[model samples]
Every structure is written in structure tokens, then in C-alpha cells.
Target: MTRIGVITFPGTLDDVDAARAVRLAGAEPASLWHKDADIHGVDAVVVPGGFSYGDYLRCGAIARFAPVMDEVIAAAGRGMPVLGICNGFQILTEAHLLPGALIRNDHQKFICREQRLRVESTTTAWTNLFDEGEEIVVPLKNGEGNFIASPDELDRLEGEGLVVFRYLDNPNGSARDIAGVRNQRGNVVGLMPHPEHAVEPGFGPDSPAGARQGVDGLRLFQSAISALVGA
Candidate 1:
């Protein structure tokens, strides 16, 4: 089975959900501790969301130096797929694995709601299962979800089609409505939404049929599994 590692930091709250999402996607989920330097040979890595280190010192600022992140950074450089969700996305940017930074919301308040996002690109490993221009709804919860970047960097991201997912409603004042972005090699992806929370049917976002029937986020985990299998 394809094994995916989910790293748990000191204050991580979504590691279990991430692991469950991996299992639902037909991959074995391995628990990786923040203090560890190895990934246990997993095919891919997922940096799940949560208030790592209690969100002290600017969200992910401190978690970037975790021992597990060292291995994650190296493995991602070697072409191993890595996905960072919400606070995890912050850490990726702080670690320079992905571009841009996530700052506090414009309203300076925590926001939690079902968010609509458009899949801008399917070239990344975590998005291959999605169709280009597809609209997906998932749960989004964060205080520091605002994504910001320089004009030049934003232009480069747009020019290279590196913007993976874009918010349809512009919830957090992210640059160009970017909800997610992938690195140049397309192996690393970071986004400010909680896809894992919407992976299971009957418990995710509301579907067209009714409430809590959406499984749109499941494709992300499945996409990674498929990518690893193809690799």
C-alpha cells in the first residue's frame, strides 16, 4: 500500500483527521512526530493544519524548525510530494518550501466556514484527480489565513500557472484570491483550507443534494495516492 506520513507538532489538532483522510484514500497513514528526523519511507507527506506551537510567534514561525520539517524539506526537494494545509501552509512558506506568507485575517478575527475554491491547475501531484476549473467546497478555519506576496512573485505565480486553487468568494484577502499554490517542480503544495475535514461523505460540506453530503475534498488525498502509484 502507498504509505503517507502525517506529521504531528506539539499543538497539532488535525493529524488524526489527516491520517483518516489518507486511509479513506486507500493509503496507509503513518504518524510522524515533530521531534523525529525520519519519515519512515512514506511515499508522500502531509503537514496537517492546527495551531502548531499554539500559534505563537507568528503562526508557523516556530514550527518551521521542528526536526520532522528537516526531513520533509529534504524529501520535498528530492521530488517527494508534500501537501500543507492551513497552518501547515504557513510553516511551508516560513520554511521557504513554498512561496508567499499567510498573515492574520483582515478582520483580525478567527473565521470558520465552508469555502468555495476553484481548481486552477491540475498539474500538481495533490491536484491531478481534480479537473481544471473545477469548483470545490471544503471547510476553512483559521485566524491567519490571509495570503500575501510581492507583486513580482504574484505575477510569476500567475505566469507559470503555479496557482493551484483560488477562492471563489475571496474570504481572507489572499492575493489574486489564491487559496493554494504549488512550487516550481509541482511536488510541494500549500493551501489555507482544511481539505481533510471534508473528505468523508455525510460529514463534510453541504452537497447539491443536501447538507453534509459533500466529499469534494477526497480527491486531494486520492490524487496524491494516484501520483505516488504512477511514480
Candidate 2:
């Protein structure tokens, strides 16, 4: 089975959810602790969301330096796939795996709700299962979810087709409605939304069919598994 590593920092709250998502996507989930330097031979990595390190200093400032991140960084540099969600996105930016930064929402308050996002680019490992320009619903809960980048960097990302997911409703005032982005190589992706939370149909965000029928986020893990297994 394709094994995906799910990292757990001191305050991580979504490792279990991420692991379940991997399992649902027909992959094995390996636990990677924050203080550990090993990656446990997992084929891919997921940095789950939560208030890592109690969100001190900054959203991901402290968690980005955890020992396991060192291995993750190296793996990502070698073209291994990596996905970061919510606070994980913050960590990715802090680790310099992705350009730009996440700041407090423009409203300066925590927001928690179902979010709609467009599949801006299907070229990345984490988004290849989705059709380009299709919309998806997922859960988004965060205080610092606003994504910002310099105009030059933003233009570069847009030009290079690195923007993976964009918000349909423009919540939190993220720059250009960017909800997710990928590395130039397309192996690493970071997003402010929680895809894992939406993997289960009956318990995820609401879909047009009815309440809690959204499983659109499951495609993310499935995409990675497909890439790894050559499916």
C-alpha cells in the first residue's frame, strides 16, 4: 500500500483526520512525530492543521522548526509529495517550501465555516484528481487564513500555474482569492482549508445534494495516492 506520513506537532489537532483521509483513499498512514527526525519511509507527507506549538510567536513560526520538518523539507526538495492544510499551510510558508505568508483574517477574527474553492490548477500531485476549474466544498477554520504575497511573486505564481485552489467566495480576504498553492515542481501543496475534514460524506461540509454530503476534498488524497501508485 502507498504509505503517507502524517506529522503531529505538539498542538496538532488533525493528524487523526488526515490519517483517516489517507486510509479512505486506499493508502496507509504512518505517524511522524514533530520531535522525531525520521519520515518512517512514507511515500508522501501531510502536515495536518491545528494550533501547532500553541500558535505562539506566529501561526507556524514555532512548528516550522520541529525536527520532523527537517526530514519533510529534505524529502520535498527531492520531489516527494507534501500537503499542508490550514495551520500546516502556515508552516509550509514559514519553512519556505512555498512562497507568501498567511496573516490574520482581514476581519481580525477567527472564522469557521464551510468554504467553496475552485480547482484553479490540476497540475499538482495533490490536485490532479480534480478537473481544472471545478468547484469544491470543504471546511475552513482559522484565525490567520489570509494569504498574501508580493505582486511580483503573485504574478510569477499565476504565470507558472502554481495557484492550485482559489476561493469562490473570497473569505478572509486572501490575496486574489488564493486558497491553495503548489511548488514549482508541483509536488508540494499548501492550503488554508481542511480537506481532511471533508473526506467523509455524511460528516463533512454541506453539498448541493444536501447537508454534509460533501466529499470533494477526498480527491486530494486520492490524487496523491494515484500519483504514487501510478493509477
Candidate 3:
């Protein structure tokens, strides 16, 4: 089975959910500590959501220097797949793994809701299972979810097809409503939504039929497993 690593930093709250999602996708979840230098040979890595390092200094500024991140950076440079969600996305930007930065929400408040997103690209390791233009629902909760980038960078991302997911309603004032993006190599991805929270059927977002049905996020984990199998 493909072994997926979920990193746990101080103040991280979603590593367990990310591991569970990996398990549900038929992969083995490897728990990795922030202070550890080794990644334990996992095929891919997930930087789960939470206020890492108590969101001190900045949202992800402190956590960017965590010991495990060094290994993650090296692994990612070697073409290992890395998925960053929410604060994880902030860490990715702080680590220079992906472009752009996350800032405080324009509303200046923590927001939580089931969000609608349109898949803009499926070439990334984390999004390969999704179809282009497919709409999905996932949970989004964060205080610093606003995505910002320079005009040239935005144009570059668009031209290179690196924008992976786009918010339908522009909840967090992200540039071009971008909710997710991937690195140029397509092995690293960062997004503000919490896909792990939406992977389970009964416990996820509710559907129009009053049933709790938001398993759309499961495909992301499955996609990583598929990519590993193909590799």
C-alpha cells in the first residue's frame, strides 16, 4: 500500500483527520513529528490544517522552520508529492514551496462553512482524480485564508495551468478566487480548504436531500495513491 505521511506540528489539529482520510483512500498513514528529521520513506506528505506554533509571529511563519519541514522541503524537491491544506498552505508559502501568501481575511474573523469549489486543473498529484471544471463541496475554516499574489505571478499561474481549485463565491478574497494551486512541477499543492473534513459521508457536509454527503474530498487522497501506483 502507498504510505502517506501526515506531519504533526505543535498546535496542529488536523493531522488525525488527514491520516484517516489517507486510510479511507486505501493508503497507509504514517504519523510524522515536526521535530523529526526523517520522513520514514512515505510516498507522499500532507501538511494538515491548524494554527501551527499558535500562529505566532505570523500564521505559518514560525512553523516554517520546524525540523520536519526541512525534510519535507528536500523530499518535495526530489519530486515527492506534498499537499498543504489551510494553515499548511501558509507554511508552504513561507517555505517557498508554492507561490503566493495568505493574509488575514478581509472580514477579519474566523470563518467556517461548507465551501463550493470548481476544479480548474487535474494535472497535480493531489488533484489528478478530479475532472476539469468539476464542482466540489468541502469544509473551509480559517482566519488567514486570503490568498494574494502579484499580477505577474497570477498571470503566470493562469498561463501555466497551475491554479488547481477556484472558489465559486469568493469567500476569502483570494486572487482570482483561487482556492488551490500547485507548483510548476505539479508535485506540490496548497489550498485553504479542509478536504479531510469532507471525506466521510455521514459526518461531512449535508446534501440537498438532508443527508450528510460530502465525500468529494476523498478523491484527493485517492489521487495521491493512484499517482504512487503509477510511479
Candidate 4:
């Protein structure tokens, strides 16, 4: 089985959920401690959401310096599949793993809801399972979800098709309504939504039918495992 690591920092609230999602995706879930300096030979890594380091100094600022991050950074540089969700996305930016930064929501409040998103690029490791233009509903909860970057960077991301997901309705006021993005190599991806939270049918966000229960987010984990094994 493909082993996927889920890192747990001082105040991580969603590491367990990410692990469960990995398992559901037919991969072995490895629990990695923030104090550890290694990735434990996992096939992929997931930085789950939470108020890491008590959300001090900023949501993910302090957590970016955790011991586990050094290895994550190195592994990602080597093309390892890595997915950062919500506060995890913030840490990725702080660690310079993904371009751009997540700041306070334009509304200046913690927003929680089932967000609608369109799959913009399916070339990324975590999104290959989705088809381009696919619409998905995932749970999004955070205070600092606004994504921003320099004009040049934005132009590059757009030109290179690196933007992975886009919002159907602007939520946190992200530029171009971008809900997620991937690195130049497409191995690293970060998004301001809780895909792990929407992996299970009954437990996930409700679909329009109210009975079909959406698990649109499960494919992200499954896709990462497929990408690793294929490599």
C-alpha cells in the first residue's frame, strides 16, 4: 500500500481526518509528529488544517518552522506529492513550498461553509483524478483564506496553468477566485478548503439531493497515491 504521511503540529485539528481520508483512498496512513525531522519513507505527505502553534504570530507562521517541515521541504523539492489544506496551506506558503500567501479574509471573519469549486488543472498529483472543469463541493473553514501574489507571479501561474481550483462564488476574496494551486512541478498543492472533511459520504458535505452526500474530495487523496505509484 502507498504510505501517506499526515503531519500533526502543536495544535493540529485535522490530522486524524486526513489520515482517515488516506486510508479510505486505499493507502496506508502514517502519523508524523511535528518534532520529527524525517518523513518516514511515506509515498506522499499531507499538511492537515488546524490552528497550529496556537495560530500565534499568524495561522501557520510558527508551524512552518517545525522540525517535520525541513524534511517536507526537501521531499517536496524532490517531487514528492504534498497537499496542504487550509491552515496547512498557510504553512506551505510560510515554508516557501508553494508560491503566494494566505492572509485575512476580506470579510475579516472566520468563515465556515460548503464551498463550490471548479477543477481548473488536473495535472497536479492531488487533482489528476478529477477532470478539468469538474465541479466539487468541499468544506472550507478559516479566518485567513485570502490568497494573494505579485502581478508577475499571478500572470505566471495563469500562463502556466498552475491554478488547480477556482471558486464558483468568490469566498475569501482570492485573486481570480482561485481556491487552490500547485507548484511548477505539479507535485505540491495547497488549498484553503478541507478536502479531508469531505471524503466520507455520510459525514461529508451534503449534496443537492441531500441524500447522495458528496465525497468529491476523496479523489484528491486517491489521485496522489496513484501519482506516487506511477512515478
- CA lDDT of every candidate: 0.92, 0.92, 0.93, 0.91
What does candidate 4's lDDT look like per residue over 1-231, in tens digits?
899999999889999999999999999999999999798999899999999999998889999999999999999999899999998899999999888999999999989999888999999899988889978888999989999999999999899998999999988889989889899999999999899988887888865446448688899999998898888
Q: Give the per-residue lDDT of model 3 (tens digit) for 1-231.
A: 799999999999999999999999999999999999899999999999999999999999998999999999999999999999998999999999999999999889989999988999999899889889988888999999999999999999999998999999988789999999999999999999999998877777754344447788888999998888998
Error of 2 at 138 (Å): 0.4
Q: Please provide, for model 1 over 13-104, each residue's C-alpha lDDT reduced to its tens digit, 9 standing for 90 to 100.
A: 99999999999989999999999979999999999999999989898999999998999999999999999999899999999999999998
Which candidate number has the best lDDT? Answer: 3
Q: What is the TM-score of each candidate against the true structure?
A: 0.97, 0.97, 0.97, 0.96
TM accuracy, model 3: 0.97
* lDDT comparing candidate 4 with the true structure: 0.91
Error of model 1, residue 92, in angstroms: 0.5
Candidate 3: global Cα-lDDT?
A: 0.93
| Model 2: CA > 4 A from native | 208-212
Which residue pairs overlap in candidate 3's backbone?
none
Instruction: Report the poorest 10 consecutive residues by lDDT, candidate 1.
Output: 206-215
